[model samples]
Target: MSGSFSTPTLSTEKTFTFYSQEQGNAYAQARPDYHPTLYQTIIDHHLDSNGQLETILDVGCGPGNVVRALSSHFNYAIGLDPSEGMLTTARSLGGTTSASGLIRYEVSTAEDLGTTLPQPILDESVDLITAANAAHWFDMSLFWASAARVLKPGGSVALWTSGRNRIHSSVPNAAAMQSALDEIEERHLRPFFEPGNLLTRSRYVDLPLPWALEQPIPEFDESAFFRKDWDVAEDFFAFQPEVNMDVFEKITSTASPVTRWREAHPDAVGTEKDVVRMLRRVIERHLHEAGVEKGKEKVKGAIHGVILIVKKKI
Candidate 1:
C-alpha cells in the first residue's frame, strides 16, 4: 500500500490541469480564508486615495477568494483564471451575484489576457489589480507589460503570497524542514528550476506606483499586517475532527509533486490513484514529524505576509 512515487522528468510542453469542478468546489470549502486585516491593508495601500474604491481586477483568482474578500470595497470586481473548473467554483462561491452585481468571473490565462477582456475594458479602465498566490504563475515580463497597458495612470498593482506553514519554531525542526525542502528542490525541482525546466521561473519587478491620481495614501506599513507562525500540531491539525478532508484532497491535487508525477508518468497505469496515495503519505508524515500525533492527523503552521503602498510618480 506504500511505495515511493517516481519523480517525473520536466517538460515545457506540459499542459497544466487543475482539479475537477467538484474538486475545486470542495477546495473552496476547506481552504483557509485570508485574513480580513490583509484585505483592509491592501485597500488602504492601493485604493484608499480615491475616497471610494471602484473597479478591481483579480488575476489567477482561484475560486475567487480575493473577489469574495474584496467585493464590498469596489464598485465592480472581475476575477480571471485559466482553469474553467476553478472559475466555475468561483462563480458558485457567490461570485456571479453580489449585492451590487459587481462581481464577474472570466476563464483566461494570466499570460494571455486579451481573450478575457476586450480592448475597451482594458483601456485604462481598472483602478486596482491584485493577484494573490497566483502571481508566481504569470509570465512576469509580459504580464507586467500587459498590466501596465490596462491599468489607469494612477492604478495600483498588489502581489502577495503566503509562505509554507510550519508547526514548530524550534531551530532544529526549521532546519530540518529547510533541508528537506532543499533536497526536494535539488532532487525533484532543481532541474526544472532553470529557464527551460518544467516549472518556469519568472522574475518579479517592484510594482510602480502612479503619480497621476493623487489620493491621500497611508504609509507603507509591514507591522500593521499580521505576522503569524504556528506549530501545525497545535494550530492546524488539533482541529482535525472538524477538518474537511475533501478540501485537503483538492489542495493536494494541485501540488507540484502530483502534477509533476502525472506528467512524468503519463503512460503509467493507475497513476492518479498512486499520486493520491503518495501525497497523503507525504502530508501525513510531515505533519507527524512536526509533532502532530499519528492517526490523530492534523496540520499546524505559520504564515507571514507584507503590504506595500506607493504613490504614482508624477
Candidate 2:
C-alpha cells in the first residue's frame, strides 16, 4: 500500500503534515465507515428520560464520519477538525437523513473551543461530544478543559479507536491472509507510528483521560464523572463487507504510514514497480497459492473497536 524504500526509515513527523488535499481524498474514499449501531449504543446510553438530545459536537472529526453517522440523534450536530483538507472532503461527501437534524463542519482544533464555535455552543450547552480514532492526537489537557466547558450538566463524552487488531477474515486461508497483513504492519508501517499512537496500538487501554488518574483533574470531579469501557463483543458483526483485492489495497493505502511513505518517495508511487504494487503482488501471489483470485474471491474481516465513555454530573 506504499512505495518501497531501501534507504533509512522516514521520520514519523511526516504524519503530522500528511493531511494534504489528495491525502484527505484518499482517506475519505478508502477508510471503513463506523457501524450505525455503535452510534445508537452511545445514544441509548445517554438519552434523557424523554429520549432527546439537543446538540452534539464531534471533535477531530476526520472527514466528518462520526457526525454523519450519529447526527440523527441530536437536534443539531457540529464536526470540528484542524485539517481544512479533511473538512473540505467531508462537506463534499457527508449526507443527511430525515431522522437527523442540521449538521455543520468547522475548521477548528479541539483545543480552540470558544473562538471557533458559535455562541450557542456555550458553556454547559452540548449534550454529547465524541472523538473517534482521534483522541490520541489531542492535547488531553486542553481537550478536557474544552470538553468540560461545553458539556451540559449530564452530558456524555465518548472516545474510541478502531481498525487495530480488528480485521479478521472468514476466507478459507484466513490465517495466511492475516499473517500477510500483520507482516505488512510489522515490517512496513509500525516503525512509522508516533508515540501518541500507542493508544491505538494498545487497543485504547493506554488512551489518556483526565479521570484515569488517582487524582482526577478538577474539571472532571471524581464524584461527578464516571467511566467505562464499551463492550465490543468478541463476535461483533463485521463493520465492512468482504472486499476484492483492489479494495483491500486501497484501504491499505489510506493508512497514515503508507501515505507518509508515498509522500517521502513521491517519485516511486503509481509506477509499475511501486512499493504498494509490489506488496500487492506478494499478497496476491499468496492468495493465488491459496486458491483465491483477484476480482473473484472476496476477503472478509471483523473490525474490532475499543471505546471509553465518561458522563459528567447533572
Candidate 3:
C-alpha cells in the first residue's frame, strides 16, 4: 500500500472556526454517541487479560465525546485539540479529572504534542491513541511518527467516522431521495470524486501514519466491532425547513463563488433577502417533487465502521 503521492493541504481559513463552544455544545447534543459495545470490543481485542488500560490519548477530542465514553476504562486520559472552543465544550461535558486525578486536557495540534504538553509524553509511553473524524485533517507523516514516538510497543491506534445514511426506508420518497443524492453527487461531489482528486487518489494509499510508524500496521478487523443503521427524522426536517434556510443564506454570503457573484453585481447584497426567498422557493419545489412533507418523515440509514485492536510490533 505504498505509493508516491502528494497530500492535500487543508485550508486554515477560519471558515469552520465557528465550530466553537456554542457549535460544539450543539454538536454534542445533536450528534449521536457511539455504542458502548464498540469501545468494549476495542478494549477486548487490544488490552491484556488483566483488563488494564492506562495513559490513553484522544486526538481531536471534539467536545470530548470519545474521552467521556472511554475515560472510565483508563487510569489517565488526555484530550487534545487545536480548537479552544471545542476544548471548552469538552470540559463542560464532564471531561475533567479522572478518578485517579490523572486526566487532563491540552491545547495542541497533532504534530506538536510533545512540545505543547508540560511533561513531554515520551516515546512508547502511551497505551492507546484514538482519532475520530479528525484524522483526515492531520499531516499523516507527522501524525504517524508522533503517534509512534508517544505510544508503547504494542499500543493501539483507532480511527473512526460515521456519516448520514440518507437513503433509509423510513423516508417517504426513497426514489426521490436517491435522485437528490444523485443530483448532489453530479453537481457537487463529482468534481471532488474525479480521478486525481484528493479523495479518490488517497483512497488506496497506505495513510501517512502507518508508514511513519515504521511498523507493520495490522489489517483492519471489523468483526471485533459493532455497526448500526437508523433513521433520522429530525435531520430531514431541519435541513428541509429550519437550518437550511439560514445555512444557504450564509453560504451564499461568505463562499467565494457567490461572493464573486455579489462583487460582479454590486447590488446583490441589497437583494440578499430576495435571494434567500428565491432559494427557498427552489428548495421547496425540489422537496415537493421528492414528496417531502414537513414533519411527515425523517431521514434514515445505516451507520457502520470498524473498531480495530491495533498493536505495534514488539
Sorted on lDDT, best first, the list reads 2, 3, 1
**How would the candidate models be sorted by TM-score, starting from the highest?**
2, 3, 1
- In the range 199-306, model 3's lDDT, one tens digit per residue, is 222332244435343453343222333222223433212123333444434433432223334445566455634443344344545556677775333334433333
The local distance difference test score of each candidate is 0.53, 0.66, 0.54
Q: How close to the true structure is residue 282 of candidate 1, measured as C-alpha lDDT?
A: 59
Q: Candidate 2's residue-wise lDDT over 63-110, tens digit each? A: 877888778767788888777778788888775633554578876767
Candidate number of the best lDDT:
2
Candidate 3 similarity to native, TM-score:
0.67
The TM-scores of all predictions, comma-separated, are: 0.65, 0.82, 0.67
Which stretches in model 1 have alpha-carbon errors above 4 Å? 1-20, 48-52, 96-99, 111-120, 165-167, 170-250, 266-293, 304-314
Put down candidate 1 lDDT per residue, 45-73, tens digits, no spaces.
Answer: 66455423678888878788877788787
Query: Which of 1 and 2 is the better model by TM-score?
Result: 2
Pairs that collide, model 2: 4-275, 166-304, 168-301
2 or 3: which has the higher TM-score? 2
Against the correct fold, how does model 1 do in TM-score?
Answer: 0.65
Give the better candidate number (1 or 3) by TM-score: 3
Backbone steric clashes in candidate 2, count: 3
